[model samples]
Target: MSENKNKSGVGMKRSGGMGGGPMGSFAGPIVKAKDFKGTLKRLLGYLKPQRVKFIIVFIFAIMSTIFTIVGPKISGNAITRLVEGMIAKYTAISQNTALLKSGKDAVIPIPSIDFPYIGNIILLLLGLYLISALFGFLQQYIMAGVAQKTVYNLRKEVEDKLSRLPLKFFDARTHGEILSRVTNDVDNISTTLQQSLTQLITSIVTIIGVIIMMLTISPLMTLVVILTLPLYVAITAFVAKHSQKYFAAQQKEIGELNGHVEEMYTGHKIIKAFGREHDSIKKFENINDRLYNAGWKAQFISGIIMPMMRFVSNIGYVVVCVAGGYLATQGRISIGDIQAFIQYSSQFTQPIVQTANIANIIQSTVASAERVFELLDEIEELPDTTNAKLIEFPKGEVKFENVDFSYKSEESLIKNMNIDVKQGHTIAIVGPTGAGKTTLVNLLMRFYEIGAGSITIDGVDIRDIKRGELHNMFGMVLQDTWLFNGTIMENIAYGKKGATEEEVMKAARAAHAHHFIKTLPDGYNTILNEEASNISQGQKQLLTIARAILANPTIMILDEATSSVDSRTEVYIQRAMTELMQNRTSFVIAHRLSTIRDAELILVMNKGSIIEMGNHNELLDKNGFYADLYNSQFTGANLDNEVI
Candidate 1:
C-alpha cells in the first residue's frame, strides 16, 4: 500500500534532503537564489491573472500610505492656525481699547471662535482617514484571496507531480524534505505575498510621496531627508547579503534535523531495543546545534537593519530641524510649512526601515521559491507506452532474459540474469540480506527499469503492457503491512472496489482474518488508527492478505509474509497463503527455508545471481549451496530464525 518499491539495499540509508522543516517552522531559507530574477518572475506569474485585483491593491495601498504620510502635515497646519489666530485676535483687541472701555474694563469679549473652520477641517481629515481605511481593508482582503488561490494551485500541482514521479525520486529524498517543500515552502510564498508584498508597495509609495511633499515645502530640507537615503540602502544591502547565507544554512539544517526526528520517532522501538537512546539524543543535538548556529546568525545579521537606519535618520532629523528654523527666521517659509517639512523628514526614514525589513523577508521567500521550483523541475517517471496493450489475467508464465541492472550504473548488481517460470508453478526466491530480493521484484513490477533485458508475461513483453493492466495481474504482500485509518472491512476490501459485504467476509475468511474480525467488538466495522497500532502485527498482515485475496490476481508475490508473526500465527498464515496460492503462480520471497521446503522450484540466490534452481529435495540431493543453507538451520550454523 505504501508503494515502497526498493525498500531494501542502499535506498534504506539516509539520503540528505533538500530544504527547511518544522524546527524552523515559518522561517524559510535565507539563501539567495541562483537566479533571483527568474524565480521572482515565475512567482509573479501566478498573480499575473489577478491583474485587476493587484491594480486595485496598488491604488488602495497608495491611498492608504499617502493619507498616513499627510497626517502630520495636517497636524502642523492645525497648530499654525491656532497660533496665528490667537496672535491676530490679541493684536486686534489691543487696538480696540475704546470699544472695551465703552463695554466695561472687566468685560473683555473673547474673539468669536472659528468653530465652523475647525469643525470642517476636522471632518475633512476624518473623511480622508475613513476612505484610506476602506481602501486598506479592501486591498488586504483581495490580496489574501489571490495569495491563497495561487498556493492552492501550487500545492495541487505538487501533489499531482508526486504520483507521476519515479521511485528513484522518493528514494533519493526523505519524506520530511518533500513535505517541507509543499507545505512549508508554499506557506512561505503565501505569507510573503499577502503580508510582505502589500507592505512593500505601501513602503515604496510612502517614500516617494514623502519626498514629493518635502520638496514642495523646501528643496533645501528635502536634501536633508534625501542625504540619509544612501546610508539606509547601504546598511540594508550589507546586512541582507550577510544574512542570506545563514538563512539558506538554517533551512538545510532544519530539514536534516526534521528528517532525523521523523526517522527516530518511527523507529523508536528499534532504537530502544538496541539500547541506543543516548546515541540518538547525541545525534539530534548535533543537528540541533547546527540549526541553532545558522538561525542565530541569520536573525542577528538582519536585526541590524532597523536600529542603524534609525540612528542615521535621527541625525538627518536634527539637521532638518535646525535648517528649517533658520529658513523660518529669514521669513522664506511659513512656520506651518517648516513644521510640515519636519514631519515629512521624520516620515521619510520609516519606509526606509520597512523596505529594509521587507528585503530580509523577500530573501526568505526567494529561498522557499527556489526549493519549490526545484521540485517542480525534477524529471518525472518515463511516460507510459503509446501503443500499450491491456493484458487481462495473462497465463502466469513469466520470463526474464539477459537482465542487467545497477543503482549506480557503473557497479552492476544484476548481470545477464535469466529466469523462466511455468504457469501455476510456485517459485520461492531465497537470498541473503542485500541480495537484491526486493530489487528483483521492483524490476519485475516496473518500479525500476532494468538496465538491459526484457521481462515478459505469457510471451508478451511487460513494457508493451499498460502499467495499470500489469499491476492488476499481480498481488503483492510484502513483510511490511500498510493500512489506512478506516474500518477493518474497508481496509480489507480496498483493492476490490465496491465489493459486496459477503464477498469481503469470504476474502477475510480465505486470509484467516475473519475469525479475528468476529472476535472484535466492532466485528468487521473495527476502526484502525493511523499507524494501524490498535491491532497486533499478525492481524495487520492478515488484513493485507485479505485485501490482496480480494483482488484475485493471476499471480501472487509474498515477501517475508509470515516473518512478523509467532510460529502459531505463522502456521495459520501459511495455511491462508497456501489456500491463496492455489491455481495461481506465486513468487514467495523468503529467508525461512523451512516454510518454503515444499516449493516446486527453489531459486537459491547470492549477490543478485541464481546459484542454484531446482525443487527442494533435488537441491538437497545435489548438496550444493542450497543444501548447505538448508542443512545450516539444523546444524546451528545459522543462529538467526531466517535461513542463511
Candidate 2:
C-alpha cells in the first residue's frame, strides 16, 4: 500500500539537479564528481563515434578565434599610418607658415593625410569579422548535432538498462530520485555538451590566439596581462571552494521542498481528513527557509567571481595603458600598436573568465554523468537459460517443492514451503499482514527467484520457461489498479493485443463495468488522466478487472482484488471472478474470510508457513487457526492486526 501511494506521485518531481539559478549569473553551485577522471573519460567515450565532427568543430573554433584575434593588430597598424600621416602634414604646414612669416617669397608644399589607406584597412577589418562570425556559426551548428546524438545514445542506454534491472532495484529508490537521474541529470549533461563544451573550446582558442597577437605588438604589455592570471585563478578557486557546500545544500533543500509539495498534493485529501494542514504548512515553511538561506549564500559567494575578475581586469588595463604610452613616446611602439595591444589584453581576460565559468559547468556536468553511470552499473536480472523451454499448451497445474526464500540473506521467510494445486482448483491463501501472502503469488509468477527447490507448471521447472512465455499463462488484478492516461477502450484493450472493439466490450460486460462506462460523457472513449483519478476507486478496479478478463489466461492471481470496491460492486466483481476462474487455476489472497469459503482448498498461513490446509468446512470442524480466522472476520475483528 505504501508502494502504491508512492507511485501516485509521492516523490516524483524533477529537480533539475544543480546550478539552476538566476540569469546572467556566471556562478552556479558545483557538484564535484566522486571519480572525476574516470567519469570524464567515460563521458568522452560517448563522443568518440563523432570524432570527425568534433575535429571539424575544433578547427572551425580555432579559425574563428584567429580571424578575430588578427583584427585588433591590423586596426592598430591603420592607427599607426594615420598618426604618421597626420604628423607629416603638421610638420609640413609649420615649415610653410614660418617661411611665409619670414617674407622669403617661397612656400613649402603641405602633405595630405592618407584616407584611402585607412579606408582599405576598414574594409579589411570588416571582412575579417564577417568570416569570424561565419566560422562561429558553423562550429556551433556542428557541435549541436554531435551533442544531441551523443545524448540520444546515452538516453537509449539508460532506458535499456532500466528494463534489464530487477524489481528490487526500483523498490529501493524513490520514483523522483530515479527520475532525476533519467531526466534532470541527463538534461544537465546535454546542456553542458551542447553549450559549455563548445564554449570551453572557443575560450581556450581565444586566450591562446589573443596572447600571440599581443606578443607580436608588445611583449612588455603581454607580460603585464599575463601577471593577472594568478589573481584570476586565486579568486575563482577561493569562491568556488567556499561556496561548494552551500550549493550542495541548496540542491538538497530544493529536492526536499519538491518532495514535500508532491506528498502534500497527492495526499491532500488524507491530510485534510486528519486536519494536519497546519503541520504540512509548517514543514513546508521550514524547508523553504533552509532553501532561502542556502540559495542566497551560494548565489552571493559565487556571484563574487565576475566582479572580482572585472576589478582585476581594470587594474591590468591601467598598468598596460601607462606602459604603452611611455613606449609610444620613446618611438618603440606605434599608436596603433598600443590600441591593438589593449584590445588583445581585454580579449585575453574575457576568455579566461569564460574558461573559469565553463570549468564550474563541466564539474556539475561530470557529476551528472557519474550519476547516470551509476544507474547503468546497477546489477541486472539474471539472464534466462540458453536452452529455454515453452509450454505449448499450459494445464495450469502448479507445485512448489521444498522451496525456501528470503528477501535478505540473514533472515528466513517462507522456508521449506510446499504446495500442490491441480488444474481448475481455486486455492485461497489467508494470513496476517506480513505472512508472505503476496510474496507467495510473486514467486509463483517468477517476480522473484526462489532460494532453494523449484516451482513447476505441468511438470516443467518454471526457470526453464522463458519469463515472457511463463507470464503469458497467467492474469492478475491487484488491489492497487494501474491505469495510464488513455481512453477506457484503450485501457481495456491493453490486456490483449489486437483485441477488437467487440472483444473489449464483451470483457467489460463480464466485469460489470460496461454500464458505468457507458454513462460517462465520452463513454468508452473518455480519457483517463495520468493518475486515472478522474473516476472513483471502485470504477478503476472494475476497469482493471475488465482488462484481466479480456486476457483469459490459464491461471489467475487476485491479491485483494475486490478490496477497493463497495459491497455491491464487490459482489459483481466476485461473480465476474468466479466465472473467470472456472475450470482454471486461481490463487486468491484475501482478508475477508467470507469471500473464500467456496474455494476448493483453504491455506491458513502464519509467519510465512502454511499452518492449516483443507476445505472451508473441514478447517472449521478442525477448530484450528483457519476456523479462528473465519470466526474473527464475522466478529468484526481486523484480521490484519491480529497476532495469532
Candidate 3:
C-alpha cells in the first residue's frame, strides 16, 4: 500500500506536519530555531541572487500599503465637506424664512452641496485603491517566482549532497525521517517565502502607515490606540507561551501517527499473517487519542488569540471614539477626521496581529531551514583519488591483503583478512548470521573504506580506480530483489544502458524469465507497481537475475539469490546461475551447503575470520568446521548456534 494512504484507505497529506488548523498559519504550534540568528542569516543567503526581485517586492508592498492607509482620511474629508455644505444650506433657509416672516422683499440664496467636489474625491479614492491592488498583485507575482527559484536551488543542493554522502549516513537514519527533511521541511520554507514573506512586509508597512495617518488626524486619539498595543502583545505572549508546549506535543504526535501508519501499511501482510491486526488497531487508537488531546489544546489556545485581540481592540475603539467625539465638539478635530481616526484605529490592530502570527511562522520556517542545512552539512564520502585509474578491460583477478574494517571504530569486525580470487573461479562463502560472510563482498566492492589494508583488482588498487569505473566491473543480484515501477522489459534493461529489445529478451531467456514474461497479459511491457508486489517473489528474483545477466560484468555476486524461493523455483534459479557463472569470477554467499558442492573454493567463516578454506569434498574428508556445518544440514543439528 502507498504510505500516503491511511489505515481507512483515505489519502493523508500534511503541510510541514506542524498540526496547523483551518485558521491557516495562526493555529500552528510555534517551533523555535536552535540557532535563530545564524540560520536566518544563512536562509537570507539563498535570497541574495534574487535581491532585485525582493527589493521590488519591498517597494511595491510599501506603496500598496501607503495608498490604502491614506484612503480613510481622504474619504473623511469628503464627509466633512458634505456636512459643512448641509449646515450652510440650513442657515440660508432660516435667514430666508425670517425675511419672509418680517415681510421683507429680499431673501438669502440657499447654498447647494458641492457634488462635483465629492465626486472628484470619490474618483481619487477609487484610483488610489486600484493602483494599490495592481502593486499588490505585481509584488505577489514576482515574489512567488523568487520563492520558487530559491527553493529550487536549495532542493537541488540537498539532492546533490545526498549523492555525495556515504552509505553509512543512510544506514544510520530512517527513510521517513530523511524524506521529511527533503519534502516537508523544504516545502515549509517555500510556503513561507511565497506567502508569509510578502504578507510580513505589507503588515509592517500597514501598521506604520496607519499610525502616521491616525496621528495626523488627532494625536490624542492616536495615543489611545497606541495604548492598546501592550495588551495585544501581552495576550499574544501569554497564549503563545502556554500553547507552545501543546503545539510541540501536537507536532510530535503527528509524526508518531504518520510513522505508525507508514510502518503498518508497508508491513501489513506480515501483520495479517501473524494475526496482529487487532493489536495494530489498538496501538493506532492509542496514538490517535494522544494526537487528539494535544491537537485540540494547541488549537484552542492559539484560537483564542484573535478573539482576545478583538476584545482589546474594541476597548481601544471605544476610548478613541469617546476622545474623537470630544475633540470634534471642541472644534479641535473635524467630524470627517474623527471618522477617519476610527477607521485607522480599526486598521491598526489587524496588522499587529498579522505581524505576530507571521513572526511565529517565520520561526517555524527557520527551523525547517535548519534541518535542510543540516542534511547539506553532513560529511560526505571521501573524494576519489585525483587522476583515478580506469581499466578498459578488467581481468576479474581480485586480492584482499591485510584488510581490516568495522562499522564502528570501537569494535572491529574484519581484521587483517586476506584472500585471492583468480579469474573465472567460483568462491562460495558459508557462515552463520553476523559471521562476516556479506562483509567480505562489501569490502571487495569498496562500499566502505578498509581501516588498514589494500584491495586490488587486476593488480590495481581499487581505491586508485574511479569509483564509477570500479563499480562497473561487477554485476550483483542480491537475495532481496529491487525492481522499480516500470515495465518488466525496462527493469531487465536497466543493467545495460540503451539495451535493445532483442538484448533484453536474450538476457531474460538466459535467466529463465522469458517463459513467465510471455505468460503475463502485457508480456515484457507489463508494469510493476511501486513495491513490485504484483509478481511473485520468485518471479521478481528472476527479473533481477535477467538484469544482472544483461550487464555481463567480469565479476558476479550472487548473494543468497535462491534463498527465498521454493525448491522447484530454486532448481530453475540454480540452472540460471550456472550459465551466468560459466566464464566469470563469482562470489556466492549461501546458507545451504548443498548448493555450493561444485564450487572451486568453499570458505567457512566464523565471527570475522575465515575458519577453514577448501573444496566441498576436501572439507568433508577433513571433518572440521566446514564438515560439521555441511553435515548438520542433513543431521538437523543447530550448527549456527552451537558453532558460534
- Which sections of candidate 1 miss by over 4 Å? 1-29, 94-113, 230-318, 518-523, 637-643
lDDT per residue for candidate 3 within 195-310, as digits (tens), equals 99999999999988998888788777888889888998888778877777777677666667876888898798999999999999999999899989998888888788778878
Instruction: Tell me the spans in candidate 3 whose CA falls farther than 4 Å from its real position.
Output: 1-19, 22-26, 98-106, 267-275, 638-644
* Candidate 1 TM-score to native: 0.84
**TM-scores of the candidates in the order shown:** 0.84, 0.93, 0.93
Can you write out model 1's per-residue Cα lDDT over 395-496, one digit (the tens) per residue? 899999999988996777888889998998889989788788888888888888888989999988888887788888989898999999999989988969
How far residue 445's Cα lies from its native spot in candidate 3, in Å, is 1.9
Candidate 2 vs candidate 3, lDDT winner:
2
Name model 2 segments beyond 4 Å from true.
1-26, 104-106, 636-644
* Top candidate (TM-score): 3
Best of the candidates, lDDT: 2
| lDDT comparing candidate 2 with the true structure | 0.86
381 Cα displacement, candidate 2 (Å): 1.1
Q: How close is candidate 2 to the true structure, as a TM-score?
A: 0.93
Better of 1 and 3 by lDDT: 3
* Whole-model Cα lDDT of every candidate shown, in order: 0.79, 0.86, 0.86
Q: CA lDDT of 195 in candidate 2?
A: 86
